[model samples]
Target: MANTAFMKPRAVSDALSAIVGKGPMPRTQVTKKLWDYIKKNKMQNPKNKRNIIPDEKLAKVLGSKKEISMFEMTKKVSNHLS
Candidate 1:
C-alpha cells in the first residue's frame, strides 16, 4: 500500500463545521472540500491569481481577512481546524 504517513487524511468532524457543513474527514479531503467551496463560490481573486476572497463563512475562518494568498490561506485556515 502507498505510505499514508505523508498523506494523512483529515477528519470530517474536525473540518466540516468550519469548512462547509460537518466533518470527520481527512486533511486531503478537507482541502478538496475547501477548494470545492472556493471554486463553487468563485472565491479566487481575479486580479491576483494567488489570492483568494473569503466569503462570509470563510471570512470567519480566515480571521476577517477580505483577501488572502494561497500561501497564507493554509496558515489562516489551520486555526479553524482545532
Candidate 2:
C-alpha cells in the first residue's frame, strides 16, 4: 500500500485558517476545503480553468499574488502547514 504520511494532519497557518478554519487537518481535507472556498467565492478564472484568481482572504495566503495556477496554488498552500 502507498504510504500515508502525506495524509497525516498538520497545523494550519493563520492565513490559511482564515479560509479553511483553524485546526490540524489532513492535507486532503485542506485541499478540499480550499477548493470549496474557491468555488463558493467564484475565484476560478473563466478563461483558464487551471488558473485561480485568489480573493482577498486567499490573497493573504498567496502573499498577494493576483493569480496563480492550480499547481502553484498547492505549493503555496503547503508552506502554511507545519
Candidate 3:
C-alpha cells in the first residue's frame, strides 16, 4: 500500500501564510508560489544569488530575519507550513 501519511499534503500556516496565502496547500504548490513571489518582488540578493532577502511578507515566515540562503529557505518555510 502507498504511504499515505508521507504523501499527504501539508497546510500552510504562520509565516508561509503571508506569502502564499492561507492554506491546506501542497508543499510543491507552496514552493512554486514562493518562487513566484520571490521573482515578482526581486527578493533574491543580487550579490550572492543564493540568498534571499526577505521583504515585509517574507520576513514573517523567516522568523523576522532579513536574509536566508536558498537551501535553508525551503526547510525554514516548511516549519511555518505544517
Number of the predicted model whose TM-score against the real structure is largest: 2
Q: Rank the candidates by TM-score, best first.
A: 2, 3, 1
lDDT digits (tens) for residues 1-82 of candidate 3: 9656545678888667778878887777788889999989998888988899888888878776668898998888878766
| lDDT tens digits, residue span 1-82, model 1 | 8658525644433333666567544566667778998998899988887889988878777777578888888877666554
Ranking by lDDT: 2, 3, 1
Indicate the residue-level lDDT of 41 in model 1.
87
lDDT of 2: 0.92
Candidate with top lDDT is: 2
The residue-level lDDT of candidate 3 at 39 comes to 88
Q: Model 3 off-target regions past 4 Å?
A: 1-7
Worst 10 residues of 1 by lDDT: 6-15
Supply the TM-score for candidate 3: 0.81
Better of 1 and 2 by TM-score: 2
Q: lDDT, candidate 1, residue 6?
A: 23
Report clash pairs, candidate 2.
none
Write down the lDDT that model 1 would get: 0.70
lDDT of 3 at 46: 86
